[model samples]
Target: MPPPGGTPDNANYDVLVVGGGPVGLLLAYQLKRFGVSVCVLEQHEKEMQDAYGRAIALFPRTLEQLDQLDLIEPMLQLGFACRTSVTYKDGERVVWTFMENIQDTTYDFVLVLRQMYTEQILREKLDAVGARYYHGMKCVDFTYDENLPRANYPIVSTFVDGGSGEQYQLRSKYLVGADGGHSFVRRHAGISFEGDSSDDQWIRIDGIVETDMPLNRSYGAIESKTHGNVLWAPLDHAATRIGYAYTAEIAAKYPGGVTQEVAKQEAIEAMKPFKVNFKEVHWWTLYNIGQRLANSFSVRDRILLCGDAAHTHSSGAAQGLNTGIHDAVNLGWKLALQIRDATKLEVLKTYDTERMTAVQQLIRYDKDISTLMSHKWPSWYEGDRNADPYHVLGEIFEKTASFNTGLGICYSENFVNQTSALSLRVPPGSRPPDLELSTPGTDQKVRFQHITRNIAKFWVAVFTGNINATRTPLRQLRKAYAGMRALPIDAFVSWITISASTGCSPYEALGMEPFGNTYYDATSCAHERFGFSLERGGIAIIRPDGLLATGGPLDGQFVEEYFSKVMQ
Candidate 1:
């Protein structure tokens, strides 16, 4: 199928995402939300099959992001809520309870769902947003104009739609390679993936099992020495998902060592101790474990890499999907800014620097997790000795589990300064917290999520010292930003006018502590028990990711000037 007119002169899209997996879908959704035109090309015809039961953990941070996007409720309805995770070693339970302790936080539980299901949900969302997708279209080659300056006309891509014998050519101001491990997009862009591919072969099995022991659970482990070290967890009421990792030497010893039957038998033997028995197997596959990161996220300017194209690690912590999704969220808004003229193309270059650093951190963390869980004990009985093994495992589990849910991500180092007081108010790369405020004339309470749907403009929270003096400027600012009235000011920003001396709470239900004593209430006083100061009269500039862009003393002129320069 030709482009109808054989590739129109200016048919280039605002952004070209290479992969229709969850990561690419998210990128497309976020861009569309910002009113940017985007297209995703996937090498596969449809969502992945159930045989690949990968990605069981959706961290709290990711859940919070879904909530902000209005996808969390749907996701929860489809997936299982994982409140506690158990860790076992040498047949003995080490950490039987790993509960996330973030009651005061937005997301406190990880959601467990298969990667295929996750991709399906994201695809549905992408469709609703009017984002286009080309399935079974493989990107074979890509080229960038090195002769041009860094951010100008940098990348071009060539794709072959498998459904129809058609060759398509497209140009993009920004190109993201979300394609999996053997990424053709990343390779064509001349990016090198640096890391090692272990000779270990792991088999993952998902199936229904009947057992007297508690089933339908989420657990991690470093056991099964007789067969191989395996990590196991539950998929649903009838089926459980288990991964068996074996060394190359052992596999070489047995010709049929990596078969599903072998893995299923091993899993069955491992579960016998817990009184769990397998009745039948539904799906299984052998996966090679590799850990690698792209040397750079971008080449020249237009081509960038994310997800498995950028990094891959062992399946111990289920970090692959989480990291990939985070990459999509990070790059989406930046690309949208350039596409919508809310920011210059220069902002796009920062995507590589920021995302690459985050990926590297994940790689390091994954390595640590693999090593800690793979340690072997002399015997299953040893797990009963003195609680020392349990203690050691507990410490390791705590460290591995301490990863900041995507919500805790901050972009303080690149493209934005974190030390400025203004920056502090608006976390540049952090997720913005949902705040409640009332509509000026309607007396209706408005949420940030509702207001952000139609308006994608950057917000400047004007925190005036006195409510009366600020009213005139607030009204004037609103008039000036009338075109952007669809976007609401967060309650924290609107309540700035209330004299800090009044001690009035703007939205009591949110349990928002006053900026200082002037707005303190019983809840605010209780929040003070945490030993953190909540000062008032400061402005916070938040980025699209909901993180504080910057914060400082409220200066109307400075706010206007900042927007004029960035939005130009």
Candidate 2:
């Protein structure tokens, strides 16, 4: 907890992540994977309770990002798949929403699992890499030195052990606040959490239940005359989470008494015509809702904020954890590159810009969804035609389906996502579509994401139309790759040749010395999905986080210019 007693030094750790929740754990995992020294600090003395009355929905986009770390399969094994969202009004199904694999993701539907389990899986990944995760140690103060020597640690963080009251000082090149809404790092950094709080309160229950409702098998909601709006979803084991709003009258009903017994009674009363029996209760909570975002995500190009520390919103939309996971993935690899000095300092700024844009959109969407679910219509939509709350919520859900599923998340055009003049189908700042391909001269098939699994480096796929045409670009790229050997660039950049020709092997054309492994777009899906014309071959640079960075003509100079902008 005392951080092993040391002064802040660059030789120690490159990055110090506060709060070992899912986001912090993920940041640590990625940094370690990138060979960057990282240490995690958790304020809690031990693992918190399964108080996962919080985030339980893992959208498809999140699963795709998790696949990059090879952690999705284990999570899929421990969670339930929620493909449909059913909403009922007065015990009759009114809006049944379906989330398909429209993005062509490996994990199509939302996975319902406790947040604790999600954190555990990420912690296991960190443990596998021998990363340090210290619990009970909380950051009490930090000092940022902008003028310090570049080789030395710029941020000096002090921590104290909750158990022994021992104090320790640690140093890092970067400090990240992944702590929750009441984050000390955010407050100490003097960053403002801007937003408003809503009066709508909610109570949630998770446990074994017996219900006559036929739609309880998956994600469902109920809009009742008596209960308000209730969320129904399956959980790990034979458990379910039933979350319902608490009206002013209901709050008054429990006025001198709000206990588990009272909550259970209220839950039963709210279900109206459907009979719901609870055999056991695992967890329950009563809480208010608020929407807030940090004024900035990163400070001085070093101190950063993520997860609940960066933003907060109601659980009604079930976006709290899902959005936080996105924040971690977006920032993790960027920070790793920054630590290695592989990317320009300005490149790290995109972490703040891109994620802030996404978080702000989430806030706007959550505001509408929360209001509708609470049966409180905003002033503009109060007419009889839009009277029904269930109908309105369904409409908003349809409109914002992309954000909800994490598929529609596309970063704004920036240094990293310049418009590709090559006219590829996948635009810069958007994730490359997942398509099936195979190794050169072999029948082994693989998903396009398989090539994108590594988070520490960028992958440049040279789509040469034929083996003969690959000779020049391959030779030039091999020379460029050799030039990068002197720098730590090899740690952050990789090259691969993808041939559209079935007659010749990509391995023989490029040789295995420079390009690690050649892949064949035999099915022609890659060619179509990437908008690659056989006449005009192109090179697509996939970022460390699996987003398309840039694409242009298949020339060595074009590849060098792309790397020159991002790497040292």
Candidate 3:
């Protein structure tokens, strides 16, 4: 049912996303592509002018998400692709890790771009979809009618337009807060942001620098010691971003309270080992470190929080924008489905469970990275002379960087679950590799890329040499879980039949040979490297984000029973 006074014809919104940052805008774009009506509210009158200088790494998973949205080509054109990163301490080189191992996977390299530029691209996408956004509208309050049944809860929101003193009220069935740290929507919902704020302040600068620094040698550089840490990386054409972090003692000792000049000087000093000299600076800012996580991502019957609104941590991890955008992707499709009246409201609860878990894992990772980067590590002199401290630190650096890039995120215990008795050639929580496949209906060769879209949607991939025997059960399952209950029956499932005689199987495109009785294709190399294990003959349930839900021997009864458990 639509909210009161809503236009009867178009009175109900499938989802209302607050904040117009990259994450919120991308969420709206994805939902709109699925035919969901969405409205976004942004407190700022316009997009940000300056770069945030926060995230420099776009992990393979994030790049895959961008590719799914068809924004990769433009992004790749605008940003620099980083294939390798090196870390140095004092004069000793610690570690260097190349992205080549993961190249055949989802992302070949991390794409570095300014946050402002990223937001601009996402805004253009939203415009293309005809999604609506209200600028200068800051959400001030939210109310939920809990008296209504769980499925029919009415969400009301009040916002004060910065341009106009007049207040406006909007009602929707679902609300998402993608606002950044210090989110008004999160506060209004009375959700606790529990964490500690570091008193240490860090200065960041980005601009066209007159420096005799070599750029083509490595994708990026990081230098750290007991005193502080500094980073220099290429941005756009003829520009670089330099970041320096100072301890409280060093910040206090510096005259004029660690101003941009002081930071610039310190950055120059740190670059002494590289024999680099800077003649000019472009942009700079100083900020304190803080880490926090919302106690809960969802509240009452009306509100949900995502992105920085749900959790925040040190910039060292470079997860700020990536995680938020992912949150938007995870929630957007479900909100759209509920608005379309195709899915029950219970599905909304799963958003909290799924995303909150990911956030918690991130928090832990951030804490670890902070400890490693900060002055907590013992001095090299304190360790055994034979034990090279730099080598030990290098191993830790590689692990921390890997986690920061989001390659470590796993969803083995998501709310959606089903069990199968058939042993899949590939296991659950893994992506199906792309292979040459023949669509059962058309007999045309199709890759996994041809079938699955990156946006959030449930998918059921059935691998069977015997299509005739499986067709009846597959159809019945499709009818039972069609529409929002699963992937829309019309768009979700892809039926393929493969045999050795077929020459190329869908799994082969994914660079894997069918090992078990069943085989399926993967869209990207990331899916196979991280998730798949050779096993054959069975059905695999994949979540909207491409993570495997569960797999087993092909048995309709078992699949239905598992669905029954999770749908409740």
How many Å off is the CA of 243 in candidate 3? 1.5
**Candidate 2 wrong stretches, greater than 4 Å:** 1-11, 48-52, 101-103, 466-488, 507-515
Error of 3 at 472 (Å): 12
Measured on C-alpha atoms, candidate 3 has an lDDT of: 0.62
Cα shift from native, residue 72, model 1 (Å): 2.3
Q: Which rank order by lDDT, best down to worst? A: 2, 3, 1
Please list the C-alpha lDDT of all candidates, in the order they appear: 0.61, 0.80, 0.62
Residue-level lDDT tens digits of model 3 in 1-568: 1111111222446577888878888888888888877788788755344335555557777877777778787788888787766556556664466454453244657788877777777777787777776677778887888766534537877777676566877777778888889888899888899998766666677766655444433455555563355666777655677766677766667756766677777777656566555555766777777789998988863678889999998776577888887787777766665555545566666778777887887787566555445545443335554643345445655665555555555555444633335444444544555445444324665545435554555555544433344445445544544433443343533333233222244454323333222233322232233232223334566666665667654455655655554443
What TM-score goes with each of the models? 0.79, 0.92, 0.81
**Residue 485 error for model 2, in Å?**
6.6
True lDDT of residue 80, candidate 3: 77
- Tens-digit per-residue lDDT, 1-568, candidate 1: 1111122233577788998778888888888877777788887766344346667778876775666576777678777776766655554665455554544344567777877777777777887887777677888887767676434545678888776767888777678889889888888877888998655566778877765444236555545544454566766433677776555545665685567677777666655465555687777877666689888887766677878888899876677888887787767767776665556656677788777777777777665555444443323333454433335545655565545455455554455324444324334565555444344324454444334322244445444334443444444444544433333332112222222223224434222332221222222222232121235344555555555555555444545554444454
Q: What are the runs in model 1 whose C-alpha is more than 4 Å off? A: 1-11, 47-51, 89-92, 145-155, 220-229, 236-238, 248-253, 376-393, 422-457, 462-522, 525-536, 561-565
RMSD of each: 6.4, 3.1, 6.3
Number of colliding residue pairs in each model? 27, 1, 24
